[model samples]
Target: MNTRKVYLIWFFLFIFIPLIGSAKIDDSHIRSVVQILIYDNYSKEYISSGSGVSIGGTRVLTNYHVVEDIIKQPSRFLAIICLTQNSQSTPDCSYTAHAYYKYGIAGTSAEYQEELDLAVIYVNNKKDTNGTWKSIADLPMSEFSFDSINPALYGYSMTNIQLGDEIQTLGFPDYGNNTITYSNGVVSNFWMDDGDFFKDHDGVLAIGTSAKISHGSSGGAAFDKDGYLLGITSAEILDGNGSFLSGVIIPITTFNWWWEKVLGYEIIDGVGYTTGSISKEMFCKILYKDYDKLHNTCVCPKGYTENSNQECIAGSTPGSDVKIDNSTSLKIDPQLTNRLKGYILLQVQSQGEAWYVNSVDGKRYYMKDGSTAYEMMRKFALGITNSDLAKIPQQGEDKAYLSALSNLKGKILLQVESHGEAWYVHPKTGIRYYMKDGEAAYALMRYHSLGITNADLDKIPEGIL
Candidate 1:
């Protein structure tokens, strides 16, 4: 069979038969999972079912294949979410809601379903007391109860999950009568998709786990022991004889690309940071552990103050600061300071303090404090574009940059190709730290501070531009 045809056959085999459960899971996690029921548009008769987990609000994330047929011909098919289980442990038809067509990736090619099998569906209608589907209006929007994964544990930029980490899968499988099932397993392999599109991507696209999932488990949840949603129950790998091999999962990193790049949602640490997405109370609570400590990071949307220097120092009061003047009468010839570019000079005549020579302008800036150090690093950064930066091997990529770093210590490099972000190359470790802002520069200064004589600083003249 062709690859696409074989995948179609595999998708059908993996999506319909009842799925997951042998290990115990929390009740809250069980309640958050739902069964996706497909029905005939005209007859209202149940056709097929798959599993999904609530991400937030009314959105449920699942495999694209589970609803692919309905998406192809919405006029002939309908999809609804079953919120609870009946006496038979199957998805209860009573507590049901119709899914509102929402954002999802259908993929550019059928062959790419192995990497692109994901979708987001929304539930808008709920069954009333009279068994009639009505617009959900029973409770206050704030009172809507739905279990969601903590954003902190969503693990987008996280990489602590190793090859042998334990994992669990939760979904409804056919053998389990379309009821929520949980299974425990270990991550066996981490691999990329067999396509050019994702082969060169940054991280692992899929994970092969011993944790088993079945047909109805297509969109269910795979969680780490700490409740971090590792991925979704996506596919099953079979041996040459069509026997079970290992369950394949669509890793959260795959979801990260679609959720952020495709959907245009601003995600900060895996949580939507847009308006009406996360409340200030919830944001502070999640970040600082106390709503009142919002000032600690100065990241809150409102009520933060800036100093006369326009620096957003945490807990600084307005009108209580004086700005430092960058202007000076000191003069130095370009010829005299040109060779000292990118050098960290020490003033032996003073307190034996060190200063940075701007590689771009060939000027010396004092590293008086963290704030000043940050300002000076930015003012002196050498604009190296990406194509140019790539030529300099910071690591094993190229050794020329390393050779230069040996002589040019305490250099400030600016990636002009990017957002012009500044970075400080440590004099000893040769490591680079992102100078995010004054606060970050302050921390970098303390950690990478070096002492030298004042006589060396006097030899270098400050440049006036």
Candidate 2:
């Protein structure tokens, strides 16, 4: 080769090679990546330290640990991907994701097991179209190869990485408090297997420099000075000096292998390449399924107790009974003071009878022939020559009082007659009650009417008659 030719080749290499390397990544690009938050259903808690990436249009890449259990029992868990941007305010942005794929590990042992730790989750870009999260585009895939020594086995290290390379890793770390904290350090060495740090896989080796990782930073990403992704943050090394110093990362090649298998896609130039439409509904459905399962297995709504049938039933407690003033021409039921303290009035209707009475909170109450409100004073005072006994009114032969009683408490007064229940006047609130014989009628009447059978009524306190 001539000297002139050699000079020209050297110039080209100096300029073009650097440009190609520079094209791989930059500071702005690194900021777009994200950390994932995983929920553990079995423990009913959050797994703060998962790692992930935002692939354009709200789609995210993460480790299977971030969403595996959630997908397995849709009812028990959910996943959220978080992106941090630069703003005067906090840079955090969150997106709910559906687990589209969970790549399985090949073996029980770390060495034999193909690190199938990759997971893909779909985010609804349309729903969150505000660009709150950076979109991923032009991603590289596993099929793409770079020319170098041992590329197949050793994998590509971060470009431009030297013994003293200054690098920054991003992740959500635990501070014992439930929030993410950031840590920074430099590359300690090129490759140092100071024990299982690289060997037995018991812990991470010292390939790069960093402070000890906190609780939630596992699965984060590490970037070189040029902002190109070096590796996925996996673990760290603690030294005998009581100083934690190095972070171990899975080479990018491992990410590529798992990405290809799980996403059914390829990468071009460090960008993930996809070929089909991903549905948002399917993604939400995954979370919804998990939410439903958890909700069902958990406790019932408040103010209710489980019945013999495992169904929720209303709570029961004693209520008051009051008397009416029969001497008054209007025959107004005696207004029971503090009537609202203990019981609610429920109205019910029966085809055979037209009126009935019940008690709550130590008080006997009566409903008019068609009223829903339980007139507390009427039951004790109406047609009663003595305070202990009262005359039961009969509308006609074979047709006794059909109104039912209940004990409920609420401010709103419901009109029971509109639903074909009998009307009765309330002495305390002056509201009218109508009786209907179903649960709706009882609820509408705002009473404790439990659709109690005649047999059940026999169990009431003797004073409740």
Candidate 3:
């Protein structure tokens, strides 16, 4: 071959090859994809199944099964279309479907049966000024010729998945909850079975991944590496070990006949449409239900009242009289001794019991019965001495006094003697006096200091002294 001919062939091949590779959908396109949430009349609750692809201007492409019954039984079922994005961060957007069209059920018993599971619905905007119902745009449909199966299969597989891909399957399982449950797994296989479609009596099986599929995931969309709409995740086979064998996905080509006949549009080359900003209130209502009947529980968090199907309103303030009993002792950290002291002082002022010592982390410390503050200090290895007790000044009259001050200091070391009233004579200071009683004999307690004003002492009952 001539050099000029070879160079021309190479240039053509490079351009065409890259275009072929670019034909497949990627993950970025899938983020705009959504699942269909529907209310089931039989269960009397919300359920979800997959279908998605935001074509443009809020229009979406989805399967018939996802929105079928809701369209047929409007009063019994409502549709909530969710756009799949970062489910953890971005809240799932929900739109009430306003209109829908079904295909492939014509002239067959399967039409009325469960098999013709394909349909497209227009999602309703919560706030439409013109009152005209809006539909999410369809995904760009690629052309496929049945004669050339290899290229068609390759295109579908590449669009459907990447090796080691982790994808979610959105579906309504038998439990019948409205929330979308995601099952993630890697792509295990990709193959085509011309006879398998006829055998299973469905559409073409162009791609297969190992992601889990349940009773409700029949119409969900499978996104590719760049998050683009690739194929519809359909079914799964389970083994005896409770493990999923393979997930079957129908390629976009399966919808080609319906797209042309029902939708009446040609496949275009471009990104899918976008929708208007979803309302926060509408979004919350569709994504989460306000009532859960099975458990007889309200979906709203505690302290909020259910305002609607999916909303909550702030309720009245909690009753102040509903007191939580503090019968258990709270332990204090030794390192927070000053804080504990302040807490004890406050409790004393409030006439509340400063019943126990607690650790910083909230574990309680207990003291033995008949243990005084001095005895407790000794037990905890504080080494408080006899001389320290003698320093406390005496007060009041001699008949009320119980002993000489020096001997009283030694008596205070005994846990049983330290609590309650005691009369002590200060022999060296020439003063006879009295000491006040506490709650219990030998209980560790803080004494009212001599500096305590007479007014404060008068507040105490005469009998309590």
Q: Pick the candidate with the highest lDDT.
A: 1
lDDT of 2 by residue, 200-219 (tens): 12222224455345435555
Residue ranges of candidate 3 with Cα displaced over 4 Å: 1-31, 40-44, 47-51, 90-94, 99-116, 127-203, 240-242, 261-263, 272-465
TM-scores, in order shown? 0.49, 0.37, 0.37
In model 1, the Cα lDDT at residue 41 comes to: 67
Candidate 1: lDDT of 6? 14
- Predicted structure 1: clash tally: 17
Candidate 1 accuracy as lDDT: 0.55
The alpha-carbon RMSD values of the candidates against the true structure, listed in the order shown, are: 16.2, 26.9, 30.3
Residues 1-465, model 3: lDDT tens digits: 000100000011100001111133323333544556565666766655544544432334555555556655766776666543433433253355533221100110111112324444545433234554332211111110001001112222244344556544444333324344455455555554565332222334445566656555666556544344456666665555645556666565545433332222334234232122333333233323243435433354332434432233222132211122446222222233322221111133444322222211111122223344323333221111223334445454332333433333212221111222233223233232342322242232333211222333222211100
Number of the top TM-score candidate: 1
Off by over 4 Å in 1: 1-24, 85-90, 94-115, 137-145, 151-158, 193-201, 268-465
How do the residues 377-414 of candidate 1 rate in per-residue lDDT, one tens digit apiece? 54445444455455444533334455643533456666
